[model samples]
Target: MRRVQVRKTHKLFIGGAFPRSESGRTLVVEGANVARASRKDLRDAVRIARQAGAGWSGATAYNRGQVLYRLAEMMEARRGALAAACRGKDEVDRAIDRVVWYAGWADKLAQVIGSANAVAGPYFNFTVPEPTGVVGIVAPAEPALLGLVSRLAPPLVGGNTVVVIASDAHPIAAVELAECVATADVPPGVVNILTGLRGELAPWLAGHMDVAGLDLAGADGDAAELERLGAENVKRIVRGKADEQSPYEIAAFLELKTVWHPVGF
Candidate 1:
């Protein structure tokens, strides 16, 4: 009798195809080979994100919150898989914690990040944070899970759709998180994730005309090229600060809009 061997599955998740990158590229990861997404695939993700974003952004804040919390719940349920994908206890734990933390923020962000403002010039004013539409994030390479979770949370919590490029070296955990997003009830385009080499893909997304804002937190070395690319479209660039644990990240992904009204006579 002859022994049978099973082949491993390596494909891109796009429009439900799960096909290899259109460019037919592959890269090595953890002694295993994985598909390397092409520029065309990245553009496909952007198109998906754009088509789905308006409806997602228009969805009620409560609906968005429900979806985000659901993703966190899903993440919690899949901790074991995520742990395995990330390949470490600390990585998995931090990722899980990030989901839980951001889960709470979904409903509370309006209160925590918004406030009433007193206008010295006789008008009544209040300010609140609003979603800036489709956000493109370059997921960080180090501390993969936590960085990925941190990058995704704040923007989605604020009702924005996201297109994230997962870490190149450690891509599994990021893809696993996409499962959480899909099951969490998030609209398809609301959290489109692309698994590829960030160095290759980030520039294109940063410069994409349709992207409303950019989060380069996952990028390295001042992200000078990303910044320049984003400038072409006037996309808001969220700067990476020195403090990794700062709540400022929550606000960086948001836009402050002030509404003013006359104090009636």
Candidate 2:
């Protein structure tokens, strides 16, 4: 008798649990059948993200940093597998390092991006950065692992929950990364991964009123239409080159809040 191998069914990660697509559809990509996430899936992800946002955002920066560091550790432990999934060890190494880099910034972002303001009156004023709530990301098509990590880390470090549509052409790495997220002490719903056609999902994500921001790093097809939909909710839209990493990427998903206190009271 011959031993049989059981193939794994990759599903959408929503609210910390893996679930089949609401539409019960799958597309063959890269020799594998991946969930073809529908608009309903995107909407469900946004709802989960919104529900998780407050808890994740209200967490102490130190705690968030620790959680991110844990994710890096999980990635490091699975480096070989992740590297193989992405077809490049170097990209996996860089992705792990990127997570660590963002982890370090979690606690420092407030200091680096915010400041005390000088007012003429007897008032002490200061500005602070706050998470932009739920964010939607279109992960890049190539360099799948690195691009996804780069786009995800910053917003996560800044305390935003995300609904990410992984690269349709190269979604294996994203599915593997979702496993890491599930086991790395990350809060459920803080990061949801949907693997499907960008064309099918980007419009719905951009137009979602509850999603506060959109990262169109790997967006394809009508850019104008995406922007137009985003404008409906006044969402903060960021278009960037793939694999670009910067603190400003995190700032893009953050809103600055100012406070005023009586100085001589």
Per-residue lDDT of 257 in model 1? 91
**Model 2 segments beyond 4 Å from truth?**
1-3
Q: Which ten-residue region of model 1 has the weakest summed lDDT?
A: 239-248
Tell me, by TM-score, which candidate is best: 2
Question: Could you tell me every candidate's TM-score relative to the true structure?
Answer: 0.86, 0.97
For candidate 2, which ten residues in a row score worst on lDDT? 238-247
Tens digits of per-residue lDDT for model 2, 2-83 = 9898877888899999998999999998788999999999999999999999999999999999999999999998887798
Clashes of 1: 1
- Which candidate tops lDDT? 2
Error of 1 at 167 (Å): 1.2
lDDT of 1 by residue, 1-265 (tens): 9879774555666643456788888888755577788888888878887787678767777777677777768877888878877757777777666666665665666687889986688788998888787888888776667778888887777777788888887787777787777677777677777776787888888989888888887778748988998999788898553225434576776788999988877
